[model samples]
Target: MQAVKNRNSSINSIVESVFDKDAANFWLQKFNPLWSFNQALGKIINKDQTAVDTVSLTIQTNKKFKLGEAGQHHPVIVTVNGRCFERTYSLTQLDVDHVLLTVKRVDQGIVSNWLIEKAQLGDVIEFGQPYGDMLLPQPSSPLLLLAAGSGITPMYSLIKAALKSNVSTPIQLMYWMKHEADAAFKAELEMLAEKHANLKVQLFHTQSEHPDSRLNESYLNQVSNLENTTVYACGPSGFVSTAEQVFKSAQSFKSEAFSLSHLASDDVGFINVTLTKSHKTVAIPKGQSILVGLEQQNIQPTHGCRMGICNKCACNKAQGSTKNLVNGATNTEPGHLLKICVNSAQSDLTIDL
Candidate 1:
């Protein structure tokens, strides 16, 4: 609501009338990101630790917030040590008023560990718009949804959305994990499978006693309609890499690896970078993200979900070229929009940073 947006100014006017203008904006922006425009926000009503180092957060989302697409992720912002850190979490719509976010704590994951170990009830978290192309294929195109480890989160969303929509698209989900006991949403998936005739689930145990039952030719041979299926896969990079090779013959394929590999820069030297807004120049080291390089010189650009999913770190390239660290894509166009967290300076660069 425009009135809600104006609420800050109204309160600021009241505070400024009594106190000072600087105090109003300072304390407002410090307490809440909503003091600014185009910011997302949510409140955690409940959180469930479903597994070891894994959490499912049920957020009471703002009424003004636009919901995310099935299988897409949104930014989750939290405050620690007075500094806000943002990370992306895949969204699963639970009801009209609430959405679920399942997060897995990664090694040295600052935000993830905070959510797991420190967050409490009634904590309000800021967020950004949801993004990612991990969605259901067309109804005419059959689906093979492959997931591993914590990658099952988005697959869970995709499967549930399709089933509820009652489309005739046949879906086969093959979820693999280290062990059956370690899988998330196992019972829920089974129940969904039983309720929907079009949904079929195949669970594989990678750490089984007999053998390493990872996805392979044998698994591919057992799945139906491989030739007709459009594939969606998510997992660890190694597992996703393996699934990509096995499903090479599918009609079409798309996948999201949980982590991106660090690539060596071809140019073994620093590139001159000009922060357009700051009007500052610095040498961005090769293979270092524009985000990190900026942080080195105390140029803190706005960012969220540094993994390149939330697009909060997106900045326009006024000039020069950059390379994407995630997908290995390259861009050289003037005014090109790129995520600084997962892109490196490829030439003398001018950014809207």
Candidate 2:
């Protein structure tokens, strides 16, 4: 009885120490935008060169690491060559004490270069909270998933979750890539298809020697039973545009464009924007972007894609108007069509950031 009582007291003390207010406050720094998570001194359990520009990193997390849902991304913060950078990578798999993140090295991308070249086993790093709204559909509904190149990262998580749950719903995944080398997760995808009978996949190769064509309207038409399928896409701007137009025209399709910009040829032009809320006026130079101008004034807003596609930088245009830099569409509507990333101020204006 004495031993049991002592053990209980010891456990209580440890728990109290871990969850004390001061500890909570310290741990909270992990989620701040300016700050990042503390290194837990975990070894890189696994790593894989998933594709030409993509790699996977698996890290063992300590007890303090928070659990994140599938389809969310974690902001990885690292210092490469004395330059600190933060980049979000999709979580490919989740376990009780570890996380698998698949990252693609973008051309001249600061963070990607660092992770590929500098990140190694036992290296301490920090990260921010997981974010994003993309998630798996209900188990009862069929899903149509499309991905291009590294955009396959997020879908891997969703598929893993569904397979783990033994979902009865069907999934049709179409992956588009330039070449066989650029197709990451191919072996894993094949294994998944072999394991899950309800999962179907098609590889769309734009530069293939064979007839496997790029994702287009005709290819979409070839797929049967699309009207009942919920579409989810992540890819380059052109690919997303083509996919969305085809699916939205024929069936219910929702898409998430991982690319930064999705501006059309005619959307490029200068225009004016007014922010009625702050009463601040600024001129969007002919060649300057609204985002850069706003940042010059130290006005920061929620953004993922710095280009016009993600719509995260959409500000409320209380009054006045602006024009798209890539398309000729003019935003005459005061409260509608506000994409500050690509829009330029043509006249004197105010903005609500």
Model 2 CA lDDT for position 351: 65
Candidate 1 RMSD to the correct structure: 5.5
| Residue 34 lDDT (model 2) | 20
Model 1 residue runs over 4 Å out of place are 1-41, 138-140, 205-227, 236-252, 263-269, 316-321, 329-336, 346-352
Residue 346's lDDT within candidate 1 is 87
Mark the 10 consecutive residues where model 2 has the least summed lDDT.
Answer: 33-42
lDDT of 1 by residue, 1-353 (tens): 89997998899778657876456545766876335333456778899977667889898876557788898887777898799887777888989878888888888988888888888877878776778887777545788999988888999998888887886678888988777677788888889889888889888887878646778878877777787889998876566767888988898988877675666446679899988788889987868788998888787888765666667789788999888766567888997787888888888998887
Clashing pairs in 1: none
- Indicate the residue-level lDDT of 344 in model 2: 65
Q: Could you tell me the C-alpha RMSD of candidate 2 in Å? A: 6.9
* Candidate 1 residue-wise lDDT at 191: 92
